[model samples]
Target: MRVGCPKEIKNHEYRVGLTPGAVREYVAHGHEVLIESAAGAGIGADDSAYIAAGARIVGSAKEIFEKSDMVVKVKEPQPQEWAQLREGQILYTYLHLAPDPEQTNGLLASGVTAIAYETVTDDRGGLPLLAPMSEVAGRLAIQAGATALQKANGGRGILLGGVPGAIPAKVAIIGGGVVGLHAAKMAVGLGADVTIIDRSLPRLRQLDDIFNGRVHTRYSTIGDLEEEVFAADLVIGAVLIPGAAAPKLVSREMLSGMKKGAVIVDVAIDQGGCFETSHATTHSEPTYEVDGIIHYCVANMPGAVPITSAHALNNATLQHGLALADRGLRAIAEDKHLRNGLNVHKGRITNHAVADALGHEVHAPENLLYVA
Candidate 1:
């Protein structure tokens, strides 16, 4: 099998799909790797490094898309890249298709077999492939929110960790999953007043034990969410619904009730956002004011630290990627967890969550592959 990796072209996105080490692993598996020129530049790997790893350096992304049996990428294909996708070719990447109708339509029109990393599951019912980036984004949310809280950034001019005799900023995290847990860790470490709201009582109890009373774990309710969010100096939207769009927990009316100059870092912006006012921003311009509340909704928050993001992402995805390269659709047919990652295959939506979210026709991956 020939696997191709093209340079990521999203705004300020520098992470590549495969590292030289990952390429070497593919070579060891008897797979030919084609990396587009400068594909690994984000992670500081050069063409010479890929060559040493037994990967051929292709001149352009066009050649890679045209020739490779499977295309590996860090982010979803942009308009031009999706245009190059051919029928029967495999695309393994993060396809947040629920919120992006344009991208969904493009993939369907291209007739490509698209496996989304975000929807991939593990036996523990955890999103293994999305965990690494979620961890990065979760930690980064605190940093970004802190910066946005500065007076110059249209925030309330309060320090996250207040000095003696000063009150610390209140941080409300709207989920208790991987992103929320890490965000809580960062906020608590900085001496902020942290409260995590979730509907899962058992998970809340687990978090309460983990924090040992340092962090407040609240049962999420409409009233509780309103109170916590309104009182918070910084609110981190970390809620997720797998392949579906994130629920809008903070509405526009609710934002108006929040403290003036409050900051909201929607870590769930990639799956649409938990804040009603949230819109995807780039690192160059990460925050905007909505109803006097600052919103830092960078869709690719992990991309801000490409070195860590790329290596972490590659570590989580390499094994599944190798499986696909070695056996193609047969890998998905055999692994139920990997099959959950199939969002689109041969012009049909394969994931139920994604299909329901986007109102698209659903097709079972096994049916499409004729696996039986």
Candidate 2:
């Protein structure tokens, strides 16, 4: 199998798909690895590193996409790269297709095997590939929110950790999953009064046990969320619905209830955001004011720290990449968890979540991979 790694082209996106170490492993397994020139440079990896790992450096994106049996990437393919996609080639990446009708249509027209990393599940029902980036985004959300809270940034000019004898900032985190948990950890560590709200009691109990009363856990309800947000200095929207778009838990009306100049870091912006006002922003223009509330809704928050994000993402995605390369898509189709990752195959929407998201008919991956 020939695998291709392309440099991310999204604005402010610096993470690369594969590292030299991953290239070496695939090469050692008797597979060919083609890396686009300067693909790893954004992640602090160079062509020489890939060459040392036995990878062939390709000059153009066209050659890499045209020659590879499988195309691995970090973000979804942009409009230019979308034209390069071919039928039967496998695309393994974070395809957030729910929000973008154009990307959904593009993948369908390309007739490729599209396996979304965000939807891929582990045996424990955890999103393995998405977790690493979620952890990074979660931690970064606090930092970004803190910066946005500064007076110059249109915030209340209150310090998160606060000074001696001053009141600490209050943080409200929506959801209790990986992203929410990490945000809570970071906020609490900074001495901010933290409150995590979730629908699951078990999850809230787990958070309670983990934090040992340092952070408050609330049974998530409309009233409870309203009360928390009304008093919050920073609100982090971290809700996710697997391959589907994120639920809008915070409405535009809710914004008026928050303190003036409070910041909202919607980490789920990639999944269409949980905040009603969030539009995908770039790192260069990461925040905007909505009713006196600041919104940090960068679609690729982890991309701000490419070196760390690339290595962390590579660590989680490498095993799955090897599985698809060694055993081919058929083996992945046979595995139930891996099969769930198949959003599109042969021009049909194979995942129900993605299908429902775009209002298309869902084709079972098994039906697409093998004839009955």
Candidate that would win on lDDT: 1
- Candidate 1 TM-score, true structure as reference: 0.99
RMSD of 1: 0.9
Local accuracy of candidate 1 as per-residue lDDT tens digits, 1-372: 999999999999999999999999999999999999998888799999999999999999999999999999998999999999989899999999999999999999999999999999999999999999999999999999999999998999999999999999999999999999999999999999999999999999999999999999899999999999999999999999999999998899998789999999999999999999999999989999988999999999999899999999999999999999988889999999899999998899999988999898899887888743
Q: Over all chains combined, what TM-score does candidate 2 have?
A: 0.98
Worst 10 residues of 1 by lDDT: 363-372
- Tens digits of per-residue lDDT for model 2, 1-372: 999998788998999999998998899889999999999988788899999999999999999889999999999999888778888799999999988879999988988888899999999999999999999999999999999999999999989999899999999999999999999989988999999999999999999999999999998889999999999999999999999989999999999989999999999999899999999999899999999999999999999999999999999999889989988876676688779888988889988877888899998887778722
lDDT of 2 at 350: 85
How does each model score on TM-score? 0.99, 0.98
Per-candidate Cα RMSD to the true structure, in Å, reads 0.9, 1.1
In model 1, how large is the Cα lDDT of residue 218? 92
Candidate 1 Cα deviation (angstroms), residue 109: 0.9
Q: Distance (Å) between predicted and true CA of 58, model 1?
A: 1.1
